[model samples]
Target: MTVVIGFEGSANKIGIGIIRDGEVLSNPRRTYITPPGQGFLPSETARHHRAVILTVLQEALEQAGLKPADVDCVAYTKGPGMGAPLVTVALVARTVAQLWGKPLLGVNHCIGHIEMGRLITHADNPTVLYVSGGNTQVIAYSERRYRIFGETIDIAVGNCLDRFARVIKISNDPSPGYNIEQMAKKGSQYVELPYTVKGMDVSFSGILSYIEEAAHKMLESGQCTAEDLCFSLQETLFSMLVEITERAMAHCGSQEVLIVGGQLFVIKSCRFFFSNLTIFLFSKSVEFHRFCIDNGAMIAQAGWEMFRSGHVTELPDSWITQR
Candidate 1:
């Protein structure tokens, strides 16, 4: 069996996956998010990664019934992630590759997230909607590169959510997304927030400020309930994303909409609304939350593909992280 190990440490998640042959021996999985209270501290994030990277790797190898030497290749995320966090994972990968003398591939974090669904679902040439703290874009595979049709001009969706949660002082446990999602669920009313869309691209920086202002006013005046504010924020931002994604689909004249990212899993209400889009749009593609977050499985799968396709250098010194 061809065994490949994948590592992903973009943003707040540290993920590892092992795939054998063409099948994921173990589903692409992640350990957990940032610690309680603190959220997205770069130093803390790097430290957490270092603490668990080896443990998770060991668990994955045991689960796959394979040792490090049994790994035919080592694939790890290299870029489009928190630079310090990526270094933590990449160094581990580098060490493994050196010790085992296996082929090491530096995988793009964004591409790995996007490719996760493709690896799990075996879809080809699907339009991918990647939503996360560090990235928000609708990508379509074309030519030799994935084309970005629509993306956030500034501030990603998850980042906006985290900032909003902090503004409201929600517990950062589990995640800002989970905390905010709970708040929205508890919400019973809605308040109006600014809705801005520029062509096919969307902006959330302004939205965050708008929510903060509205939330501030509500807090000072005691006019809007926290539930109302959270609901309103979710409504406005999700609408913007749905609108842009629909527009991109029309522009591409394609039907597939594969979503890849972490926060996508938490926005159940938004996903429900996005489902309504299917009634009007054509041929809704697979939108599985299995690879919802960036993890090792996606990176491993992408790296293995690259290795199989002759897209990577087998030499050890040539494998460089593209942070």
Candidate 2:
């Protein structure tokens, strides 16, 4: 079995995956746990990426029982990621490729998420809804490229969640979505938040501000706990996203929809968004949960797919240092 190593450390989480003939052998992710009320800082995230990437790569190789010599190729996310973090992963990948004289392939991070979703869900030619800290788009593969049919004109889904979590004083955790998911599960009372949808693209910036205003009003009025407002906020934003995704799917003439990104782990926070879709929701669940986040495995998967399709050339030095 031909083995390949992929590197992912574009933003906050560092991920490494080992693939054998397009099948994942190991997928691992780790986040630099930020203190309460703090979203990821680029420099801090890059520092963390440098600290942990080697360990992850080694562990992934061990899981596959393959050494650097045994691997045939190395893949890394090329662009559309943080510059410093991307450089760290790229340096490692280029060094590894040079050392083993293995082919090094670079891939797009956005496309990696989409291809990984397709690979895991087997959702052939379906519309993809990618929601992450940096992105939220309704996309479809056509004419040799993944096209974004619908997306956020403003803030990304995960960013909205993180910002909202900060307002509610709950950002000590690695993922704000997880914290919001827990809060959403705890309380009641419908505080109708802003519902803004601009055609196929949605905007969450206004909603984030609205949720904060409502929460503050509730506190001043002494009507509800922070948890109640959190519940309402989750419900409102998720509803808006679902509405847009369902509409995009309809527009693309696809009944199949695949959800990809780290935020999907808090299914509780977003599953309700998909409640209105009448078609069968094919799970885009990867072979490993860690691959769900931004990481190396996703890049590798995309690279391997591109390579098999004869779309790539070995260039260890070709790296996307920035978006």
Candidate 3:
């Protein structure tokens, strides 16, 4: 069986995973969480990765019951992420590959998500809705490449949620977005936030600014609770996402829709939309959700795809893209 070990340190999270012929053998990760109202900087995130990367890598190997000799290939996320963190991961991946005498591969972060989603769900030719702190995209597979049909024009939906969470001083222990999702469950009022969807593209900067100001003014004046603002933001942003996703699906004539990324809370936010569209939840279990998030197994899976397709990265070309 083809065995691949993958490294991912794209943002605040660092992870390593091992996969053997489409099956995940081990996946371990650590998050670098900042205090409430504070966001993680690239330098700090990279330092965090540097501190714990080797430990996590050991854990992945032990959990997978594999030795360095058994690994045939080494893989890592190559870009569209924070610069320092991406460089940190690339350095480790390159070192490991040379040490083990294995071929090295650089995988695209977005393509990793799509590959893992397809592998786990076994969905053929489904339209993909990828939402995360850094990216929001509606994609479809065509001509051997994942094509972006719709996307966020300004800020990503998850970034919007995170910033709003900071504005309201929500805890960032696990993530600001998760805290916002929890608070939104208790919300009953709709504060009528701005809804901006242009054709297949969505914009969140305007709505985020509007809500941030409204939250400060209304919460101080006893006009609305934090939960109400969270609810309103989730509803408005998710509706925009749903709108563009539906448009992409219709345009692609796809019957299956796969949602992948850190923000799977879109399910609770847009459950009603599912009734009209054929949506695949992948799985409702916690493992499924974890797999959907940023992780190394996805990168390994994508690397396995590329390796089988006759792709490899030379030592000199394994650079990262920090877009």
Taking the tens digit of each residue's C-alpha lDDT, what string does model 3 give over 51-144?
9999999999999999999998999999889999999999999999999999999999988888898888887778888888899999999998
Clashing pairs in 2: 7-296, 8-295, 8-296, 15-296, 36-172
lDDT of each: 0.75, 0.75, 0.85
**Segments of candidate 3 deviating more than 4 angstroms:** 264-291
Is candidate 1 or 3 superior in TM-score?
A: 3
User: lDDT tens digits, residues 38-82, model 2?
Assistant: 777778888998888888888888777777787777888787778
Q: TM-score-based ranking, best first?
A: 3, 2, 1
TM-score, predicted candidate 2 vs. hidden true structure = 0.90
Highest-scoring model, lDDT: 3
TM-score of each prediction:
0.89, 0.90, 0.94
Clashing pairs in 3: none
Candidate 3 TM-score, C-alpha based: 0.94
lDDT (tens digit, per residue) of candidate 1 on 1-323: 56778888877778788877667765434444554434677678889889888878887887778777788888887787777788888889888888999888888878887777777666666677788877888788878889999888988888898888888777766677767777787777788777888988888898889888778788789887887788788777777877887777787766566777877434455465556557546455534332475667788888877878876545454333534
Candidate 1 RMSD computed on C-alpha atoms after optimal superposition onto the true structure: 2.7
Q: How many residue pairs clash in each candidate?
A: 1, 5, 0
By descending lDDT, how would the candidates be arranged? Answer: 3, 2, 1
11 Cα displacement, candidate 2 (Å):
1.4
140: Cα error in model 1, Å: 1.0
